[model samples]
Target: MATVTFIPAPAPDHTASLRAAVRYGVLGLIVLAVVGSIVATLLAGMPGLYGALLGAAVGGGFILCTALGVLFTAKLPATTAGAVLLGTWLLKMILAITVLAILKPLDFYDKTALVLVIVLSLVIVLGAETYGVLGVKAPYVEPRAAGDAEPGEKDAQ
Candidate 1:
């Protein structure tokens, strides 16, 4: 007869999903940016190329930054995380608005290309992030501990 030993699986890290999400989001944005740049270049030359690049940076960064903030704050308390997120959100909004306002008068980039890339990047990156997070396998229920009594039982004998 051969003796058998069972090895328990390592505990799952809760941050796995968040990390996966960020990775997918970054990859999606990069692909989208490259495609956008090529298409925009074909459509409007230098201006289109610039527009696509700028749009991708702005839109992708807007969402990616938030995910990163969340990941970084995962070890912190809920209240601290919330406060940091709120502050970051406000800063992003202000920065975005300021950037657009400054670029409003510039004719160096194609507005149509910029708008299209921004919209696409936002949607695609978000979808990719969602997919990544959902794909991660996480334990839904707590494992029973040795020596712990099951429900309805007074104590383990």
Candidate 2:
């Protein structure tokens, strides 16, 4: 009978880690941009001049937060990362509703802002999840022939 051996999959490396980081960063930025634009439009009370600026700020801030969060918690699992995102979304929603309710009684709150907040919050959470999934790195492995040298090399007999 002939003997058989199986080779395991190769481990992840630094290049993979860097690539993940970049991918997550871009995802974060895109999410922020979309959410920001919507919020800015709502804030402008119209699709006029100032809306564009507000949208940019909102989107930029969201992206920045996501990047920082990923950088700080890169070791977290995809599920845990998702949970964190969901928690943030919940908090934002609660805050928006509470603030709107409080201000509505005084005629100082805009109903449209609530919608903007909800949309932005969802974008942020989804973006974070996307980044978390992309950034995951598996264990690394050493080459099988690390200790072996080719003919005429110093370690070769």
**Candidate number with greatest TM-score:** 1
Candidate 1 local lDDT, 1-100, one digit each (tens): 9999998887678788899999999999999999999999998999999999999999999999999999999989999999999999999999999999
Misplaced by over 4 Å in model 2 are 1-3, 45-135, 138-157
Residue pairs that clash (backbone atoms under 3 angstroms), model 1: none
Worst ten-residue run, lDDT, model 2? 48-57
lDDT of 2 by residue, 68-126 (tens): 55454556787887777667656655754675465455532333443454455456545
Candidate 2 clashing pairs, residues 3+ apart or interchain: none
Top-scoring candidate (lDDT): 1
Q: Give the alpha-carbon lDDT of every model.
A: 0.93, 0.53
| Model 1 alpha-carbon miss at residue 118, Å | 0.6
**lDDT for 49 (candidate 2):** 22
